[model samples]
Target: MQADNVTRTFEDPMLLQRIPSAFLISAAVLVGMEVIGFLLLCEKHVYEITGFSVSESTWGEANEVPSKINDECAENAVMSNKEMTPLEALQTADFYLLWASVCCILVPQTMLSSLSKFFGLEYIRDDSFLAGITMASSVCNAVGRVIWGLLGDYLSFKVPLCCLLLVWTILLVTFPHLSGFEGSHLKALYSLWVCLMFFCLSGVFVFTPLASNALYGSRNMTINFGLVYSAFIIGGILAAVLTRIPQLHGQTFTQFTIGGMFCCVAFVLCLWLKDPKYPNKLKNLDVFFWFREYISLRCFHWSLGRYFRQCS
Candidate 1:
């Protein structure tokens, strides 16, 4: 499976053939999932419709549901003064920078998600323990969303970003050493570490939308967010390639180190980011003052509006 040289990898006929097959298989799997989900929804609707003929009261109750949903949907559909066109949002430098930051974090985050189970088994060799650990990690992911949201409200996005990247970098560096542990101790330690890593990774999803609205404006959010999220697909591709390195004559530890380096770079990028809600003059001031302003809800909105006016 080892390539003699870089040219040999490109020249390998079988490897090239497998590339297309892999892509086809992945596409088929995605399409299958969507098709199955759509069919299930259709089946449910058909059942509901059939039931209406059997019971008018049931249909009456169901009919009221759509109006409630319309009311909920109407709230989001309303246009606001702050909304920007998608094209306008795309032209900003912040858009590209934000996209790149997300791409960086997601590469390793994808790796951890896919490989953690293998890593757990490699260390402890316990199937039951791995299953339990994965379930616990899912809970950690949910807790992380709530925790990071509150952190952003209490402080600023920058503080959470810095802390997350720093911790994530450290985790990546130390992850390769987990192979040395054994038995119940290893399971306990490995589960805790992986859960914490998952917690850190969850911040990107929670922060991205909030940060997008804050920086790019809410008007073109749907299109702008869609464009920004394309970085996630790019990250998945990078992670897929990186994960293969170990099988292709590269070391897993080195691949992980590369991921940690990306986090370091992301941390540096975060430091350069200016808050759209605050004037440039206030960007470099103390974090304590930033939190003070953030804690005052009405004052914060008023200041942000003034900042927008000054920029406009």
Candidate 2:
């Protein structure tokens, strides 16, 4: 019965009904984050904590004031504070800061990804949390479109996708804490976050795209993909409104916690997703035919000529 439903659910060639409906929940959640983030920045005046900016105090002195200017005043105001300047030190200061930011991006990327992945699944409940979490998820996630395209041509879509999501959820929920860094608790927390993040983001971030492509065929692929993709943009708009109930950036941990819970529910909703009643489409492909074609492409003309020469 279960197998039959799973198989039946994957068949429809068009009008992706059931699965599309369920996926909307996730779309709503993701898009909502963007909308809310934008609104928070615009209206509430609350920053996302980037902490990446320069101070006015770092501006260089206007040396054109004249050589006759008070030497004592110049020394007191500018010379004494050799920290940095907007013009003189901006480039160097920016370079190092950019370097450090890039370092943070790669160094703990996987670990931070795991943390975001885990946190996304566990903690990112509302706009703010989702915003931060998605920001992180977007960076570490494997590009789904490519993976799905290849998989569509190769693997059994249903089983592979389902197996992946299941594995991801299990890894996320069961991930254990890491050893603290030199007795630092953050080190432990960071480790736990990365592992689960890697697993979960890989599962969802990558699979959603494959699922998208799978539902829409290559012929009308453009339009189908477009409609689905719109979810992201509209979701941003709707999310802004929906999340305003409790507010996002100004929202507390409790509200954010609830948002995370909603995300979990959304993940659960993915289970209801099905590929159009034919999850086994790849099984019917002409494997032998493709294999013959595959080999021929490698050295079709040259190999044929070589064989002909040998025979002659």
Candidate 3:
């Protein structure tokens, strides 16, 4: 056999370094101490879910079906199902609407996460507890990414994601009042609530890319999501401007309220996305139906399998 003297080049190379276990252990211990210190000093106050009685009326009016736009498919006319050219996708009204809603939703998270520890320390005069809240929120941020990614894969992304926004909106709207309460264990709730907010925010990071890939095509996912994600930069700038407000000026409430309203708006926009099944009609905007459909899908598969086994 002749000896060959050729070296293979890799198109993509990964760093082969391994993180030290000692460093990981030390970091974990430090973080655990920070969290424990926060919890130990945390004021015990009663937590209550204030405002809004849950009823059909509490959920707002039944969704109005938009008038069907004339499809009038011209012979060989390109449709949404066809892979969209980047320019064509950019020009569509839906994409920008989604972007605007995401930008609005992101502003609150950016501002709140940046200010959470400051807010807690200023109010309670406990540094450790507030630091703990910050750490918990960061951990939940990672948790939310994993959870929402799995959710998107198991259930199509749009509807359940919107429900999460609805829940997040409710939490944001009430957070200011609840956290500020003096005697109630509400302060503890505040920490948990902030973590949930971070959770929702992190999920959006996962969802936006998936949404872009589904709505446009995977071929364009990189550029399309990049354009959508630019909204985060815009959101961050808004957060920076918001910081100019004096802390005593009810700035926290103002920020949270704005975030809550934007989340609601995002939910509404999510309802408008055209369904793949019903070409003429818009997707059913019923939040309840979307919640139930996944369960129904699972049951249907189970039944079908049972029938096949019985036949065999």
The candidate scoring highest on TM-score is 1
lDDT of 2: 0.43
Q: Where is the poorest 10-residue window by lDDT in model 1? A: 72-81
- Cα lDDT tens digits for candidate 3, 201-279: 8877777776776677667778887888888888778766766667624477787787778788887776655323222
Better of 1 and 3 by TM-score: 1
TM-score per candidate, in order? 0.62, 0.34, 0.60
Off by over 4 Å in 2: 1-139, 143-185, 202-205, 242-256, 276-312
Better of 2 and 3 by lDDT: 3
Q: Candidate 3 versus the native: TM-score?
A: 0.60
Over 1-312, each residue of candidate 2 has an lDDT whose tens digit, in order, gives 011222322245454566677699889998999999987784446658776765565433444456777644444334223332222322432223222222222222233333343333333223354445455545444554455445644442444554544554444344332322333354345444553455344544344444444443344444544444444454445444544555443333433343343344444444334343222344344343345456668778889889999999
Candidate 3 residue 100 C-alpha distance from true site, Å = 0.9
Task: Quote the lDDT for 226 in model 3.
Answer: 82
Q: Estimate the overall C-alpha local distance difference test score of candidate 3.
A: 0.67
Ranked by lDDT, top first = 1, 3, 2
By lDDT, who's the top model here? 1
Name every residue pair that clashes in candidate 1.
83-219, 84-219
